[model samples]
Target chain A: MARWEPDAQARLQNAALELVARQGFERTTAAEIAEAVGLNRRTFFRHFPDKRDVFFAGQDQIEADLVAGVTGAPPGESPMGLVGLALARAADTFAHLPREQARARQAIIDAEPALLERERQKFAVLARSVGDAMRERGVADLEATLAAESGVLVFKTAFTQWLADGESRSLPLIIAETMAALRALYVTR
Target chain B: MARWEPDAQARLQNAALELVARQGFERTTAAEIAEAVGLNRRTFFRHFPDKRDVFFAGQDQIEADLVAGVTGAPPGESPMGLVGLALARAADTFAHLPREQARARQAIIDAEPALLERERQKFAVLARSVGDAMRERGVADLEATLAAESGVLVFKTAFTQWLADGESRSLPLIIAETMAALRALYVTR
Candidate 1:
């Protein structure tokens, strides 16, 4: 076997999600997932630190994109506007994922307490990163934190809508609409 | 020993916080906490499901109070207004706790990953409860969720300020100010 296989990470992730969704996260093992994809457990460990991490493969890239979005936002954008750009960047990532795969991954996460906790921690870290990025743009400390959290809240809302059964809207459209709704909450009578 | 002792829960909570703060969350056992307060481990379990539960003793009451605040809010109140009332109700609960104990409990939670996960879970549940309460008040589902999450965000920001060194504002006051700040983000230029 070649030392490096093409798209090993994606293959492993698909296998892991399929197996875990079918047999349940607790019942599935890392070795079993790797074997399903014709890779050894050592290779699996090389891609992900643990079984839980397989479910969150693109987390680092998502965080980096969010930070870059904030850092490279157009000048004179409000804190909330910077968050909007960051969320759009995240939407781009989610848009590339097949809806069925994303739905299956969400189901696995929703059913497992450990996975849910990891998701929460990931969101917390992402919010902190976004907040720090806002600070670099000269947004006040408290405002940065507020904007970051609100952005995550909007992302969560928009993502849920996108994942809803029979919901046909694009992720970016849902994000823009959700952001508008959030702003409307304060602006309208 | 009497089957029921007055203030047993409060005493156990105090002991648990002191022990957990001094020795750390993982090292402090339910048995040690009970013994410190002159109670048995069984009695401790009666009040709390586990050691982790000690740090979240009033969670149920806080949930109930928030729901009650939302349900009993004035007619014609906006969803966000109801969230404000619920947050104020929660602030009232925090105001009664000794600041020193609150600070110590926070320190313990901050240092422990398990506790932080539990804290995140608690907040998630609290947000759900608040959202349901809004539903009962005829708020739309999406708006209810957004308001509930945004309210929790304000509580978190205000709570952090309340716990900051040398800061002395009451929780309710801080909560109000944080809410204002959140509104300002969407309203101001």
Candidate 2:
């Protein structure tokens, strides 16, 4: 029961995640989230437009990191390698989340249809951003788009495994293994 | 303008798609959709909860076909082969629409955020269904899910290409080429 003022947004999101886990998304509301975090209704609105916004606040940072990672890869790296680096960067971003927190968030997302759809749009936005970033770096056409999309797909699989395995292993290792698996899936053909 | 009713559900969906294409989804109303199809608004509501449901009417059928194809693949067919067959069935379903109608439908979906999210959910559902079907047929854990997801990914690539190309070439051939490319992407590793 520590009173923290500057971390309101984070506190709100945490509260929302907790309620979503305990009572399910449909039963949770903005007022409940605000009360859970010891904040009033107006303060919650100032931080997030709605309850869904609380779940999505981190997406912008993730997208920015991905773009930065791809753009800042070693000069000689291929498109695939650059994309792989971006995935590694994302793994790093999620490394600090406690395993229970990660699982709770994921379970909430998995159970809610609208949230799942919003999650997909976020991924699609990231993929398109990656594609655009690739094009800026001289990769062209559908090839760039597909490479970016493929990287996101691999990252998703890797993250799923990493989270499900109790977060004992690092995300980068899981991403590497996922990339290797993708290579094998196609290479065997 | 021919008027023939097969099922109330089909008529409502067709009306919705047609109206959305002509007037845009943002402007179309359920009442107008009912008027266009010679059905009462109540009948339309009975079949679909909202306007978005019309474009997705065929989705359940597509997923059913995917499940059937994945589960019914012959004993010797590999996971990739089973994926290929399931996608071919999807292409067959898409092929039934007139090119203009297909393009019109896609255009509407591409322009709407809600519709775009719904479209992603549909693909996710199909992927999950395909994975379940594959699992039922003895495919293992992560591998089955990956194969199912990869199949949807390639199918999406092929469909985007086909729509952009105005559906001149064979859908199956385009899908096969995309699948081959995806396979090569990993195989080269």
Candidate 3:
């Protein structure tokens, strides 16, 4: 792999997002994305299996980090606590992206039904991964699944609020607050 | 539509499931589904736009029923209570299907990535609808969203446990118990 492979992949993704935003996802081509990044189609294909995958390129790494986070957490913590920490760490992975790029990508996903389906599947996969990681910690089946799924809900709700127009909270802060709020819901009754 | 329209649609769906289970989803054609049901191709198209829709045809009605349940609940009910009741009512919509048919359809979906993606999207949509219905009842946004999402987790968890081998608990009982369990998770901490 080239020393600059990561940068090249990011560039290809950014270019693809720009092209997909200008023209609909259906009209965008892999060659065009590569050309915009000053790379060849073969180079693009090396980084991404297809144009659709370019947007979801970091999913594998993110999923691994989430699972590792849960599995590596101190064993004394509760299941939901472990899941929460794992998802918070995963949120940290996205701190590197510029807001404009994030918004641009989200726009394309919001506009395309196919991309929305892919996004939902990504979240589902993350929930399953977190559940399995919980089981690896000796948690029971139902508890692990429920805690993992609830953690995912917190992650999604926080991400939505963090990205909303004019909202300025950091992802971790938002996630923590959302988790507290979710817990508080049951307490008030 | 004719008096037999509902019966025809149900037959087509049953036939589609049988064929999809036998030869796989990609290999099963619309004509074959119609032939299995002893119906014409035109009748198939009238009910479902494509082969994929045959499996998802009930989603529209189910979603509508869920939303209505939330909206029409007693004003004094908690958001989670309303959501739980709504989901239970929706389960009744599927109570008429034979257990074997439900198992066969679920097995196909579990084995196919595409069908799994569709299922996740369906769950997401239901969560959104329940949340919106909560909003309509004067509930705050974040609370409504969280409650709806948590309710979906309960619904899913109950459905999984209910459908497991040798399990025969009624859907309402299972849903009620799952919601209690979820709330209990927050209490003991």
Q: Which structure among the candidates has the greatest lDDT?
A: 1
Choose 2 or 3, whichever is better by TM-score: 3
Tens-digit per-residue lDDT, B84-183, candidate 1:
8898888887787678878888998899999999999999998999998898878998888888999889988898888899988898998999998888
Whose lDDT is higher: candidate 2's or candidate 3's?
A: 3
So what's the TM-score on candidate 3?
A: 0.93
Residue-level lDDT tens digits of model 2 in A1-189: 555579999989899998888898989889889998788888899988776788888888778878888998978667777778788787788767577777778888889987887789889999999989988888765667777888888877877887784457777787887777766655555
Q: Which stretches of candidate 2 lie over 4 Å from their true place?
A: A1-5, A35-38, A165-167, B1-4, B7-10, B45-49, B165-167
Model 1, A79-150: lDDT tens digits are 888988899888887777688778888989999999999999998998999999999889999999999999
Clashes of each: 0, 2, 0
CAPRI grade, predicted model 3: medium
DockQ of each: 0.72, 0.48, 0.64
Q: What share of the true interface contacts does each candidate keep?
A: 0.61, 0.31, 0.49
Q: Give residue B104's lDDT in candidate 1 (0 to 100).
A: 88
